[model samples]
Target: MGVEITSPNFKANAREALDDNSLQKALGLTVEKGFIKKRRLAADALPEFEALRDAARDIKNHTLDHLDLYIEAFEKKVVENGGHVHFAEDAAAARQIALDICRKAGARTVTKGKSMITEEVGLNDFLQENGIVPIETDLGEYIIQLRGEHPSHIIAPAIHVNKAQVEAEFRRVHTALPPDRDLREPESLLAEARGILRDRFLAADVGVTGANFCVAETGTTIIVTNEGNGDLTQTLPRVHVVFASIEKIVPTLEDASQILRVLARSATGQDMSVYTTFSTGPKRPEDPDGPEEFHVILLDNGRSALLGTPFQEMLRCIRCGACMNHCPVYQAIGGHAYGWVYPGPIGSVLTPAVIGIEQSMHLPSASTFCGRCEGVCPMRIPLPKLMRLWRDKAHDEKVVPTAQRFGLGLWVLLARRPKLYHLAMSVGMPLLAAFAGSRGRFRSLPFAGGWTRHRDLPAPQGRTFQQQWRARRFGR
Candidate 1:
């Protein structure tokens, strides 16, 4: 759980990810063919999907504008419901608050639903260090936990891992199981994981979960999951801890429902997730089963700082991961290359804001600006624009590499001199085309080894775009 800032080493990480054949196969199968196609079909089936996206975006925007008031209201409601609310200024404070709660409850083992906020704070290792065992009840989270790796994808944490890898990991970790167990199929593997996790779930003393939407009006925390693990993780334990960021608050249950209409369709291409659990507080005397103690931890962690800034739009993210699934760059290298709790398009913009641009300068430049991420985003967060803002900030701060800066400087100089630029391009194009005897692509090129090493670069067609435009326009 030494989830260090490897965003600085993004290029190297990307190279490694590209070379990993297994990772490539996983990306192709799970992302390109899986999420993308499913989401498209789901969106097409729902005529009001686009309108729903707009509503979701507006709902989040309203909450962000009056975030302070809504947070207070949410806290008040939780208190009225017999729940405790703790606000953490940062990741460290959040982790400490969680540990304190566990200690007070005498929790030796805690079961967890899928929680990115927990991962953001590195909670698993912290709990282990504090003599508490935190078990990931989410299938994807559990898989990565066994491998001792962070989530490579947001909703699908183990998307980078293939079925074969799971089989191997299950065999390696679940040594108590039969050596010849049939984990060749997805169902078989899921059954094996459930069997192993069922025991841990029952034995857990505390439960921790992330909030999908915290309804301020009712003081309710909603979690949407395909698997019913979240219900067990929260209900079976003596104490339940709800960890969420400040932006997750919604003004009312109606607003949450509006957003819910798009969340699953965007994330997993379902009309609705299999289980959408809502919890208000600890159990009552009349209740059948539930935790005895309920605690809510709200972590700011630089999010409050983004309130009025250009990056404020990023707070609208519901972690649906639609943007990432549609991102070309993400589909190519997978999420590990981004090297953070969040990955892909949203991560590209948010990581720098949370962690600082100087540390994550490469992330903004990771996109092709194809605009697919923005187009697919359920929140309508202008991801490409936000990424461009990061890039511009990086440039202004001189955080960009010297070579890139030099290239930009030269381009600026050329762009300002129309005649010189035209002359340079006209003279350079034919020479490049001449050098290419037959094949119209270069195997390698000066200052372009990165492109050529992986794939051929198409040679110039011996004419500048402007010249071609002139011919087509003027019939020269």
Candidate 2:
């Protein structure tokens, strides 16, 4: 499970993301407008949407407070239902456990449903290195798997890929198919992918999936999906394995329901996903179609250490993708720029917490501090506040660049002396305005080429607030 780290070079990643025309077009069409507009309409249609969000938040908070108890309860119930629950303290342990299970089952091929947890631990690569083939069954996942790319967005793994790119990938990988066949339309592409994966599903020895929620009251694992691929992936295989973080538990089915109400609306703008499958155990004696073995691998991977910290609130995330959908930075640069399993505002906070702030310090600086992410989050996570905490920690630990630290030092020095701050602003505004000429904007400016290079910087609209206040108060 050796995952490549590019978080240390986030500015470079973001610049590359911004310059890619194909990625930009895809982001503009699908991310910038599609999800945002649909979520708005869906939220507006439901009068209780906001109340549901609040309820979801409270449910997650309560479960996190008693996380150990619920996890124990869930494990007990799973045992009772004839399923095995394995606890892994870190990604390495989780990977080893999964490999052991696969080896014991004599598995040669594994079919996978969409699971970010598996991606976080680099399970597919690890399995491939060990002589097991893991196939992605989800359409988006299949596309990215063929392209050998990590997911660019949660819930929409191939969002960065356009139709033409997909068509090309299909032609390259699905060589057994007719070369002259038409795959110009998305429907045709889907049909071809479905035809190819159907055989893999039948031949699979193990299936891996992620749990949206693990219900403690009844010992259930739940997944919400728009497609039915998850059903086939789990039910058709001899061994079914779930890869999930410890934070994905709820006290009761009612609590899970409370969160589910807001999840689909926030994520895909649907009243509900097309399929919400619940798995409790291995195949029973009377069951016609189910896995012979059922296993749940709960990976902590630094999440347990965050329980009492300020970042603990991030555990409330339900992975709805709403924060990323509404995030301006994410919309501009997409998920790959954040260079992690989770992305956008939540990733900015969570990556630092899980992976260490030193390696991911640049992520927190990628935001514009816009509140849209928090506004749309169904779980009501205070994302910007969490990001600010990371930024402060980075600054305090000297993890940020020397130039940034120097700039902050200068600003802090200027801010402390009110008279000097006002005097500097008063003198600075007139000179800036005079240089702007009649355009009321500056196309080029010293120390602000970053802004002016992309778009003109509006000149100081008027005198500084302190000067206007002084004139009005003293008639100076």
Candidate 3:
């Protein structure tokens, strides 16, 4: 949110993190191999994954179409159940609402379950600025918070970070640990974190989480997680706040269940997470332990604006991270490269819309159009197509450079006339060959200095493939 991360310059920060070859090697191994394992696991588990995906997508599309009606229904039900609903048009408003609630309730420390909406609104920073401490309770989030780094992956926030790095982070951040501590095992590291976080969770006056789905028919906020931290975060503190995009609303628990069927299966290869919790409202008077106060912050934040547009399909996202996990660009460059809170295929499209399309012009173009992200998305979102629309929007807004404009223009001209295009290629090839010389690599070339600056570009052979094909067919 504070900084901009485009695909091109994110490389610098990653290179810095990769100053040691080991970190780079670690990231490469995880990004490439881990995804393959997960993909295969999901495929092996579900014989009708494609069918499930289609059903999921249709349900989401239906939900998006009736979002306004569902949201109104959700609001009415929440109020009827004694939970407060606050609508925010933007991040600042959402942050202010959260801050106001904490202040009124005399909150000191707040524990948070991982919520991307909170991250979008900068809730932690806002609270801290006002002298309230907000601790991330999710294990991955806790690690990144300690390191002052952002989440690299949506579901697996610290996916790029290795165990040793986490051990170092723990030693640096954990107060109870001795300076001489050298823990390597994940269990030990987790135990240390648990000790620290457990105390925070118990002492906190407020707890917050993001909703996976909100049922309009029942006014329930559904949270799905493996570690059960979300349940603790929602129930432990006196007050609980749920920050979510309005698009998360579905008509009923049945719809939520359908989405859930795809969420865990696509995410972690599990039929269901260890915990799939749905909190209806504030704790009943007779209930022994649950939040006394419940607040739901519905963030509009350009989301509602996209409802009727082509990008509205994005609202169907379950935040599964399947798109990013399976994304080649995200796998190679990591999340920080996207330069916004959201990353990968979803981020590439969403960030531009949330921020300005101009600032994130390069994000959509980062994709290889592989469509793997789309294929794996439980919601079956057309991620690449949406990204292309973003690119078109960027081009229309003149965010793209004149160089790109001219190049595309020339390409269009060449495509429209086959004969002249062949003639131009025939003449251009030898000149390119001469420039490339015996090495067959171009270091720098006209209008392509940006590309050749980092890596050598392979020279095109003097013979065009089309010409060779024609000659072979005719035996010339």
Candidate 4:
């Protein structure tokens, strides 16, 4: 089945996810073992880390400004190096192009590296429907594939699943293995997956992977992974296909290197991912082992339109996922609640651009505006600012609900008149404080069920800040 878009009902999805015990357990581990501390250590170790972030952002900005020229240069170099570049305007076009390539190659099986672009385009289901098997090589991805679910996290696809869940899935799917086989630990699970995927890798006719960065100067595609699966996925097959979004392009190898310096530190807290592979084209005549055919499917999917607009800064995202990792909202609920390929803060901004704001208004509104995402972002993309821009657009288009608009309208009216605001706040604070009684909190409240449903609302102190300030200044 094609990956579903549930972004329109993100609130409902988030509510349901909040109630799932299994999901909650998995999400808790993410908080305990998050990238924040490690990222801090890595950044502290490199005094030039912040400078590299600025350079990375500048490189992306410069490349985007000259994207057309660089795309031409990239394509020219690809052809010169005996590789083909296919431009896809949207998801459908991308799917059809990939399917056509598979059909031409007469591929029966294809191995895939962890590519969110492929998930975005629903490539696996499309290929399966056309009678081709698409095997996921990434261990996290492979687990999710067995469960027939989309990835919950960008880098950790099966982050919502625990070891027991994986054990159950392996037992259920790998029935050919002995029933009494020991699968108690993660190492055993890893070994089982590796053995299974190794066969798929060698038997596959086509390998599809996502590019972390595509170099314009040399027409090279790069993938950075901790596991060696991506290398195996691309090299073992006869045809290698790279799925990449338009904004993935960098002007030169040096520009890619600048971004690479920060990518791993922000992502997994490592100085570098274990494997960083660069492929310029198909294997040469004398090359020992590489794909015979190399093709890149450059997907637009509404990214081109984001240029020159307020949302253009979103294109600077390197998909390190630090934003999601640091987001309090995402930490509590996890990625599936966002109901799309991309989730967390980046998803909130980029989803609306790709799928339309009218259908994804909830995503932008989902933020707490704590700015942790922007704080942790390697490219310094100002994610919270971009999310606020989406909110403004949603309000301008009048797509926001009537209740929200009315509430905002009331606030705006009161906020415009200082005397009226002060009077209302003075009265409201006293009333709210009295309602809270000696407990100093409310477990439930009328007209604010959403806030009270999960946590208590702290009571106001019965005195407005203005009153306290006046009393302190004049002893009134």
Among the numbered candidates, top lDDT falls to 1
Clashing pairs in 1: none
3-96 per-residue lDDT for model 1 (tens digits): 5789999999999999999999999999999999999999999999999999999999999999999999999999999999999998889999
| TM-score between candidate 1 and the true structure | 0.95
Candidate 3 lowest-lDDT run of ten: 1-10
Looking at model 2, report the run of 10 residues with the lowest lDDT sum: 1-10
Please give the lDDT score at residue 332 for candidate 3: 67
Instruction: List pairs with backbone clashes in candidate 2.
Output: none
Q: Each candidate: what lDDT?
A: 0.94, 0.92, 0.85, 0.92
By lDDT, the better pick of 1 and 3 is 1
Task: Report residue 363 deviation for candidate 2 (angstroms).
Answer: 1.7
Q: In model 4, which residue pairs have backbone atoms overlapping below 3 Å?
A: none
How big is the positional error of residue 11 in model 4, measured in Å on the Cα after superposition? 2.2
Total clashing pairs for each candidate? 0, 0, 1, 0
TM-score of each: 0.95, 0.96, 0.92, 0.94
Candidate 3 segments exceeding 4 Å error: 1-23, 179-182, 430-476
Candidate 3 C-alpha lDDT tens digits along 85-195: 999999999999999999998999999999999888888887888899999999999998888877878888887678988988887777669877657888888888888
lDDT per residue for candidate 2 within 352-458, as digits (tens), equals 88789999998888888889999999999999999999988988898888987788899999899999999998998988888887999988888898898999999
Between candidates 2 and 4, name the one with more favorable TM-score.
2
